[model samples]
Target: MNLSNSLDKIKTFKKVGQVADNLGMETYVVGGFVRDILLKRPCKDLDFVCIGDGIKLAKAVADALEGKPQISIFKNFGTAMIKMDEWELEFVGARKESYQNHSRKPKVEAGTLAEDQERRDFTINALGIGLNANNFGELLDPYDGVKDLKRKIIRTPTDPDITFSDDPLRMMRAIRFAAQLKFDIEANTFDGIINNAHRMSIISGERTIVELNKIIMTDKPSYGFKLLFVSGLLKEFFPEMVALQGVDSVGDKSHKDNFYHTLQVLDNVASRSDSLWLRWAAIMHDIAKPPTKRFNQKVGWTFHGHEDKGARMVPGIFRRLKLPMDERMKYVQKLVKLHLRPIALVNDKVTDAAVRRLLFEAGDDVDDLMQLCRADVTSKNNNKVKRFLANFDKVELKLQEVEEKDQVRNFQPPVTGDEIMAIFGLKPSRVVGDLKEEIKEAILEGHIQNNKNEALELMYKLAAKKGIVNNPDK
Candidate 1:
């Protein structure tokens, strides 16, 4: 198939072809750029593979362009890059690679176009469009990548075992692509992933998390996660998640599989919000259920305090996964801790003080926390789900009302610690902290308005009760 018409539309492709022709080099726009073009997906990065010195081709192409864009060359990797007008073009020599069992890094050497294509992670990514004048825009598909694209399948270009064993990160990439493109992994290719799951230990946490985050960002992340679990890849890196899988029973009592429930929550959150950290919250909301599981004769099974435990577990998990240890991690942790709070409000009579407390604790993340709580209502009973959601709506309304009146979303006590110290002639001691806490609790409990006047009045009254007279030196 000829993509000459499509190639002609992209100015860079034409210029690159001309330059390659002039230099008597065989070059083709290969990998993801070619695949995305056929799929009509928006792609900003382009990879070009040539049979000879790719750096030289990139330099010549850069000189031929309108702005003569600066070329960034990597001498060790034998690749070069040029950035122009939202496009990132990377040039690499077509090469074959052989890996050692201990590492994913391959010994690289120049080879023909076929050799390079064979080394690609998947068939669709191996597709290439000719960038030499003689065969400009010609489609090269030795592995029938177009057919696989139509079939909606993820398959390696060569033997799946050899491919995955060479670079175990491809296992994650396979699952990620299937999730992103809504495709199925071919049986043999999937089997290969399962066979080489242990090899994932060789891959770094950073690389694995990149693929994991991509999967999480997909429209239905559960699909990728299920694949990861079934392929045994998850156990290699994240045994905590795998532990959430099974359901235990004492007589007729049993609990839902927290693993699948977490996935449902993840997908529900994905459908509502595109926030990656919020989705991470969903993934972690029930993460400690296994460790916290208990079976009581009265209640079937209870994962009491799982949310709190899960929150505590977040930092350690983030450290293990090489995820950011900043506010983002804290955000996820906070959500995990508070996920059950909104549901508790839904179950009980919604009160102003309850709503105010939620707003006060959740602060700026109250809305996101509400979204997570809504996603967590994954009851199999339709009526139960409806009832819970309707109650949630009422709870949200109450939250809005309380927040509007009290202005306590990110509430700071109207009475400051310094003020308490000055008033009571005390140092920065527990007494000052106690006064601040009391004032905050009064605001949240609706005993006093969240303003200086009421807080100051109550502070004085409480201080009088404690026999702490106000300083009169002034």
Candidate 2:
């Protein structure tokens, strides 16, 4: 395979090639850039590998670019980075690696291009496009990477066991690539992953989560998750999700497998939105069903309060997974807590009051919540699915009408603490809080209109009932 086309895209790359030739070093554009170029995929970030000093080549390339780009050198790793134009270009010296029994970090030594290919995690990533003048445009594919790329397969450049055992993070990367590219993992490589899944224990939660987030961000994220569950990778990182898998039966009746159901929901949400955490909320929406599962002779099986329980589990799950424990964590928690609200509207009468409360609680996320609820309806029966969908349409329309009329989303009570305090001439106390709650509930429940005057009047009545005198100034 020749890669003159890949080199042709970047004019500055030619200068580096000339500089490398002058310096007596063999340098090639290697790894993902080469793979993506042959696959006709768009990639801006480029990785270059050289047989000699990478820092020298990186400095040369930067210098060739009129010397303005910032070149960061890492002497310990024989690598350098430059943020040129729109992409990050990293240069590294070709090296061999030998890992320890207890750690993924390897003992590195200067080596040839073959050594670099051998160290690559996947065959597709081992392909390199030579930039040296003599072999310019020639693509080195010692591992048949182009063939594997053509077949849309995921296989390591070296033996799967050696690749994964050297760095267990490669296992996660393999699954992430397979999911993102919609490719099949080679049988031997997948088996090696399963065999070495336990080795992931040596990896840190932070490092593991980086690949986990990539898997979640894919178009069909559930595929990667299912692979993780089946191969026991998820159990090591997220036991809570794996716990949602099995079905519990009693007296000839069983509940839907919440684990697979969660995956279906995750896929459904992914089909509509690209938000990673919202998709996470879909995956964890029923995580507590197993603990809350119940069986009765009449109903067969039920998961009561699973939503509330799952919401409670969200903080713990985020903490364990190394996910953000701030607003993002709260966003997911909010979605999990309210996942069932819209669905509960489907089977029963879709009411304006119910929709208003949902809009009020969900606020700007009302649409995402509705999407999650609709995706939550994963019934196999055609009629049930159709019925739920039709009912959801009605619920959505009602929500729009209610939101437009009441403006209750992210609603602040028309009556403020100052107003309540002024009206009742009372200091900060339970009475003020009680009055605010009363005013907000009145607006939400439609007992009184969502207006300042109406709220003030309602506040007065409550204060009168509570035996508080009105402020003479008002």
> Which candidate leads in lDDT?
1
Model 1: lDDT equals 0.93
Name the runs in model 1 displaced over 4 angstroms.
Answer: 347-350, 422-425, 465-473
lDDT of each: 0.93, 0.88
TM-score of 2: 0.95
Across 265-301, the per-residue lDDT of candidate 2 in tens digits comes to: 9999999999998998898899888888888899888
TM-score of each: 0.96, 0.95
Q: Residue by residue across 1-474, what tens digits does model 1's lDDT show?
A: 999998888899989988998888999999888899899999999999988999999999999999888889999999999999899999998999999999999999999999999899999999999988789889999999999999999999889999999999999999999999999999999999999999999999999999999999999999999999999999999899999998899999989988999999999999999999999999999999999998899988998999899999999999999999999999999999998898767655657888888898899999999999899999989999999889889789888887888899997898889888887788898878888899899989999888999999999998988889988863
- TM-score (C-alpha) between model 1 and the true structure: 0.96
Predicted candidate 2: what Cα RMSD to the true structure?
Answer: 1.9
